[model samples]
Target: EADTCIADTAVVEVVPLDMTVADSTVVECDSVAEVVVEPVDFSLVDSVEVVEAVDNPSEIRLNWDDVNYIERNTSLGGILDVIVLGDNTEYVGYIIRNNPVSGIRFKTLDNKVHMLKWDDIVIYSRRPLDPEKSILSQSPLISTYTFAGLKPLEGLIVEQDYETGLITIETADGSVQRNSARITNITNRPNENLYTPKRKTTKRRAVY
Candidate 1:
């Protein structure tokens, strides 16, 4: 007959059956409540493999590297997922992916996977076709004259004759009116000059 249990603090001694309450004290209270309430297992430690950010050939400068990944499973945290591999029309810049736990970042636009560094992911390559809008069309007219020297004149005459000089040409119509008139070679052969000028001389001297 053994039964002694008086509550209100300290007095308990009642053992009637076999006892067993030890799994390392419930695994030490679940490892002290998982070390005071879990939540800190971010992995993926490193990766910046942007093989080519381009424009470094003729050299305006822009190259990138850093693809190191071997820390698998610390719970696999943020960032670190950059896979921008070559020729987005030969590249431009800005592919800095990183987030080893809220260092927050990502890239790529016209190629997708956006929204992290979201400065619009910055990726543009398709602008090189403006050689002045395909050039060819400019003639607003300003001439020193040369369509073969603007040739066109048959019987041209204007004279101030004192002995035939200020312009004169009477090769036909019973000739006799000429001061070696060649008016610049008669606009390149106007019907080979078969002139017909019976009189075109006006000289009204003295107006001073």
Candidate 2:
């Protein structure tokens, strides 16, 4: 009778074996479903990275001084970066004016004025003249440069006298006087639009 009872207990345990197999199959199905969803999560992460890349440019800030704090000694001429032709000598100072007797008058930051001749100067501009840029101007008081390679200096025409063939230019940093013979072209400024006004705008919340 004891041996018969032991055999009956073993037969009962067999039912649980089939249930364990069914539970294992369910677990495998769930794992496969999770694997499919994992790719979607990865895609979402990739999309966020792309959005960050696109928005990064908007976050960048550029800084520049609106007014020059350096005290200017000489009243005439704009601050210009000048490069001489032969020695390629570079200078940063006030180009006072084009002197009919002396040439291109320049005053150094140290307060010494120089007469840079028409033939000697390679280029002069507020910044160094880029050799690879389209030169455009809209001033009636045009003073053509003697050298073809020299870029035309565009600024406010402060003074003009056809009799002396002298034209005075009040540059951003200083003043310049040039002969009409050096001037290639001329256009009238009926509206007197020499300088274009520029306004800067930013996102209101970004100001702080």
Candidate 3:
């Protein structure tokens, strides 16, 4: 014997998820209905996108029979502190341009510009902590790429050989460009607090 809604007037619908919205919301219905929510604009104001990189250091290491994956980050030598997609949209980058079939261009650090489409990439790199091994013995190299026969980008250039978990690509064009992707996971996690580019120290004394 329980059934409520002896209709007189009813209209309640509130839908607005993500684009930042808040215009109206009031629900106390007795005989008055009017709920419409629609407002979305993910404004990336100023949109910093001025990418420019072509130095190509292409860091890598995590093969040697997997070598326990090693994990302990913080070696910004060529500067890549990268992290892509899978909800981990962190990119303090510099890959400039790695064409494995015309796809892969990252020049971020606020100055945005990220163009990745080797199937949107899943695991690019991770094998650091060996700059003479003194960052308190670092160890971190996970994700040995698992994209088998992944096609569509026409194989232009993709090289990530974490020792033996091979992945070499290059359809043509002097074919032999395998940066593959580096700085795999310099501590990737809801990351984005990067601005480490300040080093000017040189004090050498010799010539006797």
Candidate 4:
């Protein structure tokens, strides 16, 4: 026969699982999942380069081509009345009346006044009679060159003349001596007496 047994105390204990099993259990039992996202592609993008405009140099240049400073002499269209003082042989000088001014006159080869104009007059010396021996042929004889622009009875002389006084107030349309005595003041008139020969050829021989 068996003997009867009695009595006692109780104890509780826990067991751990393998590492791979534990990792697998954590992944499978997770309540939420994680994911990695990528950026989207675009059809058009912002430009990186800047563009500038250019200007033309010719548009800013200045022009100053004009002919305003030139002076032109036009004929007034009237008969230029002139007087021949002496014969061609011994014509040293002449006394001119009705001159545009109170001075002597000389002519050029082309019939144009050389130093004087229609408004001015010149009293020039004559060419030498003998060209072979004397150099006087080449000399200039313009003793007095005056103009109406000068003060009345006032004249400028390159050389002095003893026959007549330097300051001779004269009438514009009268004889020299008569005008001299009656001279009081200067007159402003366009009429002038040019001692230059009416024909240009008359002075050609003297120029050479």
- Estimated TM-score for each candidate: 0.11, 0.27, 0.18, 0.18
lDDT string for model 3 (76-192, tens) is: 432243545555554554555666565667666677777876555644542222455322123221122223343222222234543334444433233233333432322221111
> Where is the poorest 10-residue window by lDDT in model 1?
134-143
What lDDT tens digits, residue by residue, belong to model 4 across residues 29-127? Answer: 223333222223332423334443333212433332432222212232111213222232212322222233433343332455422332222222322
Candidate closer to the true structure by TM-score (higher is better), 2 or 4: 2
Which is the better candidate, 2 or 4, if ranked by lDDT? 2
- In the range 115-165, model 1's lDDT, one tens digit per residue, is 343222222221112224211111111112112334423332322232224
Top-lDDT candidate index? 2
- Candidate lDDT (C-alpha), each: 0.27, 0.43, 0.42, 0.28
User: Alpha carbon lDDT of residue 1, candidate 3?
Assistant: 11
Q: Model 3 RMSD to the real structure?
A: 23.9
Model 4 ranges off by over 4 Å: 1-74, 81-109, 112-177, 188-208
Better of 2 and 3 by TM-score: 2
By lDDT, highest first, what's the ranking?
Answer: 2, 3, 4, 1
TM-score of 3: 0.18
Q: In model 4, where is the ten-residue run with the lowest total lDDT?
A: 199-208
Q: Please write out the lDDT profile of model 2 over residues 1-208, one tens digit for every residue.
A: 1112222222222233321332111122212131111111112122221112221133433332443223333442222344344466766666656554456667766778666776665555443233342112332223333423456665555444534567666554567777756765543222223343333434322111
Off by over 4 Å in 1: 1-35, 56-208
